[model samples]
Target: MTNTPTHNRERSCIACGAKASKADLLRIVRTAEGISFDASGKLAGRGAYVCSPECFDKARTGRLSHALKTKVSNEEAQVVAQALQAHIQRA
Candidate 1:
């Protein structure tokens, strides 16, 4: 038998509050430049996760800004939304 890790890092969706594995969710990172989607999940900054586009929409209203502890303007939110949409399409 081969040894393997059983526990996976779990994260909660900022908008829906649903718990899911890190790999199953999309990560959004907040950096000095601005907040954006982290496709690689390795960005060096504060991160938030969302499980679906619906959750993302909810987050766009307010949860995301609160979770990131930063003010996300309309333009920034739009850009993030588009990026996430594209990422989802690719997947």
Candidate 2:
């Protein structure tokens, strides 16, 4: 018998419009506190995905706020960007 591996779930980056595996992307969640990175991908709130720091920067302009249906302040955007960058470096 032959065995095959199933493909991981796919999601589109809000910034670049590139498609990638959900696990390969970073998830940003909108909650009562505000917009933040959801590393577990299981946060209970609206979520958006981005493929890289560049895409994250693009999203910060407006796409991210639109996706979350809430205004994202510059500080919030900066925090998320920094968090993603740190995450990328760690990985």
lDDT of each: 0.89, 0.92
Q: Note each model's CA RMSD in angstroms.
A: 3.2, 3.2
Top candidate by TM-score: 1
TM-score of each: 0.89, 0.88
Clashing pairs in 1: none
Give per-residue CA lDDT, model 1, range 1-91, as digits (tens): 9453677687899988898889999999999999899999999998999998778988886888888999888898888899999999999
TM-score of candidate 2 to 2 decimals = 0.88
Q: Give per-residue lDDT, candidate 1, residue 61.
A: 68
lDDT of 2: 0.92
Candidate 2 lDDT by residue in tens digits, 13-87: 999889877898999999889989998899999999999999999889799999999999999999999999999
